[model samples]
Target: MDLPALPKPITVDLSRAALIVVDMQNDFCAEGGWLHSIGVDLSPLASAIEALETLVPAVRSAEVPIIWLNWGNRPDQANIPPGLARVYDPDGRGEGIGATMANGSKVLTKGSWGAELISALTAAPNDLHVDKYRMSGFWDTALDSILRNLRVDTLFLSGINSDQCVYSTLTDAASLGYDVVLVDGASATTSPQYCHEATLYNTRQCYGFSTTARDLQTAVSAYPDTCKERS
Candidate 1:
């Protein structure tokens, strides 16, 4: 498939960097998933997933920790307040707390198919996993703790819904003084094309930087390895 031209990626310090792939979940991409069941096209998601299939391994080879930042929330979803709750199923079309599609895939509850990562992206055993309740993984989660522990100062970001969770986390990361990079080719949204464009614009102009997978590889290749052993 012919992919669109992505913005040039910025070179990052490999030693202090990590690739944070956000919310590539079944509910948003798979055919019987929540978004697919609701009629949203999964093409954008497929593109990101495809990009990561190549990017994940290369980053891992660099010993850059790959954090599978997903929405592994409480089964009750008690952390989700009503204001943010409406976004999932505002129309009440059999899509709410505990709702499931015809395929027996639970909608948004934790431990359900909808809340799990899509099968496309592989989750390695050593990969850091964090279950988040909100769009921004930094909010009320162990994200900061994990990053600090890993000695990560630069964050390489990709994943689904570029305009939402990806955007939110990037903003916070920038505010907190962590150098942020958005891999546009690996970060997509089913929202309007303009939304994706706006995200790229805001990310570059406000948060940190925008980039492509090829450029990212160039950046990763620049840094020399300190300790070859994976932590």
Candidate 2:
């Protein structure tokens, strides 16, 4: 795969890089999930899931840590405040804390299948999982601590809702002085096409570089040493 060159060269150290996948949960991707029950389209997520199915293993082959950043609220929903609730349901559809969707999965509530990662994606034994209450994984989460402890400085971000959760996390990572790359085609948006394009534009112009998963896979495969594969 021919890699897309950035405007300028951006050096990414494989040893210190991490790949983070955001919000690829049943609630967001599966047909019977909460979002689907609420009339949100799950079609866009298919490509992202497909890319990760292959690209994640390529990343592991390169010895880069794969972190799953997902929305998994507490069962009590105590961390969710009025603002977040309103954003989730502006029309007041009674989809607040503890409210179950038509599919019987409570949105964002922990211990619910809806909050779990979609069945198609599995976590490797060495992979990391971080539950987030907000759009940015760093907000009220141990994401930063985990990255710091692992000495990770470069991040490749891909997943659902490119305009929201993905962008939010990318921005936060860049602000924290981490090198961020938004893996294009490995992310999706239920919103209009413009929303996805806008995210790529903004992320590239303001936050980080953007490239496809194929490009990333090629880059990872070029690493000089044979990194230890995860068991």
Candidate 3:
């Protein structure tokens, strides 16, 4: 099947844009948790981290705030949908993957693994982190308030599991009127087709555009004065 062609080269207004990293957690990306149960390879975790290495410095130099949205679930299934909670033992305490995320960025835990950010990725002091109970980052989470506080109008999204959490958060962000960007190569899924298909369908259609980290970097380098013009 032919994949969608890249959209036109676009530059966002840096002064009003922010980078939103979604549920790139160990449970989904590493050897433990639900995703591994289905035989998914998390080597993409490394790819995502590499993408961040190329993109983060550029976004940071542009003064775009980096936001990490992680999960913090409760022992009881009270916070999540009953159907989701019932899939696993509510009281079970399982260790995910091998290590915790060392990204020095501000960290937020959603669902249960409040301190872990997928066991990989770089962290920086200025990064913003928030914990979410549900799939949507805006649902009962500090994400909205943080974005508002930063005066962010554009959200550049990256992270794991394209069909579930990432897709859910992007849809929610679009409905709220924020300009969105999906860093295409910075995300992955247990199913490669799932990731690619989700981005082609919903990205830019309901939310904003889908771009690669490299393309964004180049645009930023070529148009460093973006804040002076419309995105």
Candidate 4:
């Protein structure tokens, strides 16, 4: 199927493609979550949820696999390096990853509410889930292995913090030789407008193509009969 994307339209085999949603978990998108507890605005991330609500079902209908990649850290924080830890808690405060929130959920810890997907998004039973410790989902995660097992060569990327996690994962996907497409509406960042703009610019210029969720939905809808069952 040919997808309408910026810089140029690209062709993709639906059976060999998958959608990767990064960092759309509670700690990033939900109110009273980690980023919210840090006083970051939650409004910008809402657009991503809104877009995914429609796009996810559409892509699923097209028989494309859905992979939810989220930050699910170990409770012990043993694997977390000091540099990464400092980025979150510069003062060595207890508010960073693994810290218990007011509601009693440990921030971004595995099996914690903060690391789970937000209530608004529903992950199907057969969909894949990967726990990532770093901004790039491919870093020290089973994401690459799962994609290989799925026989997916093309990846459609979405989710929160477009300028950070989303971009990081997208670039790594490219480096790993996967065809990448950044679904614009389905991804967003809490950073300034310029950061989001630069992400789009760099994605088109350096990493991969960029397109709206609506365009991808349309592309999938157009070739409904052409989609084959996933392996």
Candidate 5:
């Protein structure tokens, strides 16, 4: 199928395509979660949820795989480097990853409420789930192996912190030779507006093309009749 995207329109084979939703988890997106508990405004990240609501089902209906890549750190956090640990708790406060939030959930720890996907989004039983420790999901995660097993060559990226985790994963996917598409509406960031714009610009200029959720939906809707035939 031909997807209308920035930098140019590109054709994608549904059989070799998958959708990766990154860090749409509660820690980064929900109120009372990690970022919110630390006083970061969540309004910017919330925009991606609405877009994902429509885009997810549309992509699923077309038989495309939905891969949820979220932060699910070890409880001990032994694998976390000092530099990364300082990102969340620069002053040696106890309010970093693995810290308990006001709601009684440990921030981003595996099996913690804060590490789970937002309640608004549902993961289908057969969908893929990957736990990531770093901004780049490819590092120390099974994401790349799973994509390879599925024989996916094209990835549709969406999720929170467009300038950070989402961008990091996209960059790695491109470096690994996978065709990537950043779904603008389905991805957002808590960073400044300029940061988000820079991410989009960099994606189109260096990494891969980008398209709106609506355009992606339109493209997927055009291919329903061929879903079973493709994969």
Candidate 6:
């Protein structure tokens, strides 16, 4: 069968491009933390992380920064919305996500869990972690300053809740004038179809472009010398 045509070719300035990984915590991606009851699965989360694993070396080789974006918040039920309560409330005992993934990396927490990255994908030495309070990564977060400090001109976006957090991040990133690439497969929502469609729609409309983690890995390998910032 013929595959769909690839999107327009876009190159991230290795020295100025950064990978912004949104919430990949157990509550969001694992089998039983919070939203799993709603059908959130670990398959895509693992797949995305695996893709990052394959692409990290490439990013490191090119000197581009790999950032891990997480969420952390006070242990208060009032913080969570009524609709999201059944999934992430204190009753759910959701604080383990961040603690589970804590390691040698810059940590950023948002909400109560601080938008924790999954335990399966811990941060590396060169990784920068940022905690966000709102939907967008740039909203009162150190993300913008860090990007500016790194002279980053492009952002490779991925993570949980494709229709919410990921979408919000992409929108903000685009408005900020940074070249953005949304990894459709690297992200998953409570609903797989919704996540997929959201990624496509947002990429084709608001974001600069979209691709899968595998394809991005291929792109990185093609330009092996393009992302060597980690080592």
Root-mean-square deviation (CA) per prediction: 3.9, 2.5, 6.2, 1.2, 1.1, 6.2
lDDT of each: 0.79, 0.84, 0.66, 0.89, 0.91, 0.64
Per TM-score, what order, best first? 5, 4, 2, 1, 3, 6
Candidate 3 residue lDDT tens string, 1-231: 011224545555677888888776656665654455435576656677677777777777666788888776644435666445433234433322222334321112333343366555765898888877777899988898889888888888888666667778888998888877778777766566756676657685656678777777666655545453423
- Tens-place lDDT digits, model 1, residues 109-211: 6778788877778888999988877889899999999999888898988997899999999899998889888887899999998999999888777777777
Candidates 1 and 2 compared: the better one by TM-score is 2
Clashing pairs in 1: none
- TM-score of model 3 relative to the true fold? 0.77
**Model 2 lDDT tens row, 111-230:** 787888887888899999999998899999999999999889889999989999999999999999998889988998999989999998888788878888888988887766744433
Name the regions of candidate 3 deviating beyond 4 angstroms.
1-6, 86-115, 192-195, 221-231
Which segments of model 5 are wrong by more than 4 Å? none
Model 6 per-residue lDDT tens digits across residues 10-82: 5455556787888776556665454554344556556666666556666555566788776665344335355
Alpha-carbon runs more than 4 Å astray in model 6: 1-6, 37-46, 76-116, 224-231
What is the TM-score of each predicted model, taking all chains together?
A: 0.89, 0.93, 0.77, 0.96, 0.97, 0.74
Q: For model 3, give the 10-residue run with minimal summed lDDT.
A: 98-107
TM-score of model 1 vs. true structure: 0.89
Off by over 4 Å in 1: 1-11, 221-231
Top-down lDDT ranking: 5, 4, 2, 1, 3, 6
The all-Cα superposition gives candidate 1 an RMSD in Å to the true structure of 3.9
Clash counts per candidate, in order, are 0, 0, 18, 0, 0, 33
